[model samples]
Target: MTIILAWYRDLIELTMSSNLMTMVQPGAFSNLIQIGVLNLRLNNLTTIKSDSNSITNIQSGAILNLPKMRELNLQSNQITDIRPGTFSNLPNLPRLRLSSNHITNIWPGAFSSLPQLRWLDMCSNQLTYIQADAFSNLPQLSYLNLASNQIATIPPDTFLDLPQLMKLVLLNNPWQCDCRMVAFSLSSAEMLTNTIK
Candidate 1:
């Protein structure tokens, strides 16, 4: 029985890391594997699960086979955009890292299916605008980072729907501190005293 359990664990791990076509050992199966973790960081991937209309051939189902995948690290790539419903099937996805990419825009409902997602890291990108209601359905999201982008202004109600969000980072953005910013400054000053310092 112990040997059987060990084999099961090995199979699970193998399934999770199967989508990575980089450096797997010989005789490895690469599909329908349900590994708990999938880390494909720092690869030369220019797109994330692209589609037929996409210029790149990386389609949506590229990582769709790993159903048990809970965490995915796709940092330091050249991803420019994320199609809506790109990760609709991966129900257990809890954490996603997409930092250090070239993303410029995020379509609404793009991250809507990630019901269990708690943390999202999207720092160090070229994002100039975030469409309204982009994160409206993320009820379980707690930590979100939108730092180090080209964002100059935040649209009204852009963050109002995120009631469950506990920690949000909006630093390194060249914010235009005008009347709109004054309202934010006053509200932030009153809510979090650290804003004064």
Candidate 2:
């Protein structure tokens, strides 16, 4: 952990060659020099601790301020609600993975600031709703995965803005499978598949 702190303090890429880090000390790497990519996959991080080393609440700015950051991996955590502005500062981030977490709701504008974003994985979570225009500004987004979530109803024209989107995975969501949902499914590429309830 000390080495990880030293490397991170130098604005270096933090790669996880192993999944053994179960405890994270806060105030560890919030002010690292200029990191570009942060990969903390397969770790045991439950809550992203604050910068005070006192196990404080997760602060969105901790990861957002890494200016050169292009990719962030928080997969397989216990994260639930994603507060607004959590991703507002990651302008250069392109790939974000939050798969297999405990996420429930994605508030409005939760992902509106990512212009270069392409691949986003929020699959296998506890999400049940998607607000209108929740993904309006993601013009460059190509792949999105909302599979295995608890989603029930998806509004009309929910994906009208994602024209270039190629792969959309809605499998395992307990949809109502009504006429409106049927039409919404039609707009998606044939490559996109949804499980029927």
* Best-matching candidate per lDDT: 2
Model 1, 12-74: lDDT tens digits are 442122133322221122343556665656655554442111111133444554567778776
Tens digit of per-residue lDDT, candidate 2, span 78-143: 667676566666788899988876788787667887878899999998989887677778888989
Error of 1 at 15 (Å): 11
Error of 2 at 17 (Å): 8.4
Cα-based lDDT at residue 118, candidate 2: 93
Against the correct fold, how does model 2 do in TM-score?
0.76
Backbone N/Cα/C clashes per model = 3, 0
Off by over 4 Å in 1: 1-30, 50-59, 180-197
Give per-model TM-scores. 0.73, 0.76
lDDT of residue 15 for candidate 2: 68
